[model samples]
Target: MSSSFPFPIKPVPFMYLGDNDRNLPDLSDDEFCDLVAVLKALARSSYPRLEAVPLALNAYNCNQGTDDDGERPWAYFYPITMIPPARLDEKNDLLPNYPEIELDFEVCQDLKRRWRSIRYGGDDNNNNQSMEFSPPARYRFLCFIHKHRIDRKNTLQKGVHTISIWDREWDELIWHDTYHVDRISRRKDIREFWRHVKAPGFIDEVDSREHFMSRIRYRTVYHICEQIEETLRGPVPPRHTIYAVMSTALFHMNNARDLQVSIVPDRLELFGGQHKGLLPRFFAHLLCLCLDVRPGWSRARQKRFVLQFRILERLQWMRLRTREYLELHDSDRDGEYRVDAKKKDGGGRQWMYEALNIP
Candidate 1:
């Protein structure tokens, strides 16, 4: 006989079941078919009654939390087709269809070992109950994407798309005592139970106004001031972004900062009522600095400055429109008046041309 044994050691097929499998060089048609057959067999053997429908094969890079060796794990996306476990309904009719099962798999060497060693569907200690596979990180990500898409589509169909604010703290406060209350006690003290409860410690009247102010004032100068300083360090300051500026200003006001005067309850209501809280005050301060307006200016002068600003804004918009029209005319001979018989010509275009004194 030959010096070598009849069978040589080979890498476990399950370990290579990922996107990297596509990069495997020059396989004949038979070899490719054989590989797929092996994968199908492995999938079927792993989970009885489950059919593996391959979608995509790719290597998944695991983050620091998931990866042990920093090696990119081979990954595959497949829909595991299966019927729902039989359940008896009131009418004794089985639900015909269930939701599709999609899974992202990371092909790992350890997984192959675990797969082989673990005995499934038996009284043995190594049965499926005792041994289970930890889901890949991408599995959660995929689930989130599916859920988000469904929610977004449903929300869009309803026509009102807006960010929803959830006051978790307030919600917790409402339910915290109510959840533990005995039924009889709750029924007896229903009104007083909800109404007599004290507000949150931070906003409670137990603390003197001066004490509250002092506490919030120090917090603002320390925490908020440091954050603002850090944000202003980069070449493009965070304040340049409108959202960032608004958020920073809001944070300061929320923490009861003395921007000019103490942000008392009465002052808060006054500023917040018609102007939607501290935004107008913050905006006014910003505008003053930008326009180099003095703090001592009279209300009449301030109104005049605002009027002038509005006029300047209108002029700027007109100039922009004229420039855009000239550029479009130079680039295209037909400009906005391209011949399309199906399209209706409106008076808006004629009005624009007349207003801009364009032929």
Candidate 2:
């Protein structure tokens, strides 16, 4: 060991260098020194004012363990060890993936104001309705299945049950000719029924948040029915049947049980008083990076990969090497640094040492 370097040079762990159980070849003394030389160069370039230790490049220090300076020694010595090059490309979802949607200026402003009010440290107990605006007609329609507790898949598909529920709830609609029908013909019958009938006046009025939400649902169901009729080359579907299908689509889109009916139109350009139209796309990119494919890698490996990315992204690119190199000499050594070659906890795990055959 030299006086300039604080820690003594240590050998690579058997799992990474030995050719025994895992069929990995052992590194010769000369090869080990060469690897240390490369790491030394990296550390020196990273921290021009700080000295580096040969022991920092050892297998035990190869993971996220920090030196006395409270800095990760290996991170500065070999940046790629933290995150492989293949995974770096997906770290950013740039401006291209998300495009701005055009919207009414007044509605867009309203949406923007609402999104802004709840950004940082707001009361969680606050009513969501106050923070959220009344959704458009189309978005409102999705809520119908929820409010009425309709069985979209079964009850709505079978028009008889759906109409019975609607007739019971509204009473004024006066649904007739329902003595022994199990299913109403989806095409001609629905269209003919709508031709002579209309929803009650209260259905269209938005006196309260409930009314507002209901109105949206009704409008959206009507839109879906119209689309079905035009595309199916027949008649509009009864609101009940279409509600079932809409609910199913909503479930798939949200991919959750909470069933979020509120839709933030993409056209809104500001949020929390900041330009936010493309903010979601940026987060989407980050999510992709964190959830990148690791094929057979364990959860621990995936977590370390994400942690390295978060740390690296925040630091200055030019000083990266310096910060890592200084940790080698700036930190104190407690004992002979060693790595448990067979540890399965995933912490301080090396990539080359991974079981490649794991399925």
Candidate 3:
């Protein structure tokens, strides 16, 4: 169906989820200000619902604390719209009565060209069935807070002060506080709450920003591990190769040093799927070796592995080493070689190291 709104109804320029360079398209200060103004004005009258389009931005407070310290600002977008999917009949054909079908901005260009070809019978592509049944594209206006820039005074500026549309899919995973959802239900004005931090009703909800960073970092690590798994499917990678892959991936991320020292036991719990928490299959088996635990042990038994050695191996994986681990050194016993067991198992095998408390 056609929109009742007048001419300027078009999707804004957008960025796909997981884009590294998430800055808004370069625009002059005046243009940027005007865009925000128009969006706000439109929300006030033309689209009242847009005023409630809540957005949670992970704000990194660079001046006060480490990169991991951040606040989730209760922000909202003033201008955002979605065009609904086409009405399809029982046979999966567009309804004859509905003539005007608005194409989604995300898939419009490619779909338009392909639809043209199909209508004219100009192409006989075998992939048409897949394309026809593909899920509808749903785009939404989203924003990313720019990394703080150092001002002339050498202090980090409050970045992303104004909203400029950098679009994303509606279902994209965002940094949000679920608490606000309940607050909004109670009719709390979140925008005002964040704005007036010193207000009597204001609550201190700011939390360690590492969780958000961890999400991103974990995705990066998982994908890297996935690629490594796919490439070296059969043979177990040597310790050095395994170490190289893990170290390089961690080194590139924020708080690399700290992360390498230990991946919280809870974080290990996060890794799971068809491999049954033993993602990449081989990596899990090798993890036992790194921590001096038995290989091919079930996940329950694996959970009891020593945290310290795993962290050391994980750290080694994140860094570049010119030399192999020294077999004679005392530290080598911590990772490169197994430590002498203080006791023996019921089966008469030497017991592995005792599980250390997670820091």
* TM per prediction: 0.17, 0.18, 0.16
The CA root-mean-square deviation of candidate 1, after full C-alpha superposition on the true structure, stands at 27.6
Query: Native-vs-model 2 lDDT?
Result: 0.25
Candidate 1 colliding pairs: 19-57, 19-58, 272-277
Task: Decide which is better by lDDT, 2 or 3.
Answer: 2
Please, what are the lDDT tens digits per residue for candidate 2 over residues 131-198?
45432111111111111121233233323212211211111122221112222332223323223222
Clashing pairs in 2: 19-24, 46-321, 46-322, 47-322, 68-331, 76-324, 116-272, 140-217, 141-217, 152-244
Give the alpha carbon lDDT tens digit for every residue of 230-305 in model 3.
Answer: 6766322211121222222222122222312223222222221112222122222222223222234554454443
As for candidate 3, its clashing pairs are 247-317, 247-318
**Which has the higher lDDT value, candidate number 1 or candidate number 3?**
1
Clashes within 3 Å, all models in order: 3, 10, 2
RMSD of each: 27.6, 26.8, 25.2
Candidate 1 per-residue C-alpha lDDT over 226-345 given as tens digits, one digit per residue, 9 for 90 to 100: 344467652222112222212222332333212222222322222111133333222222222222213355545544443322212233332343333323321222323212222245
Q: What ranges in model 2 sit over 4 Å off?
A: 1-122, 126-222, 236-359
lDDT (Cα atoms) of all candidates against the true structure: 0.25, 0.25, 0.24
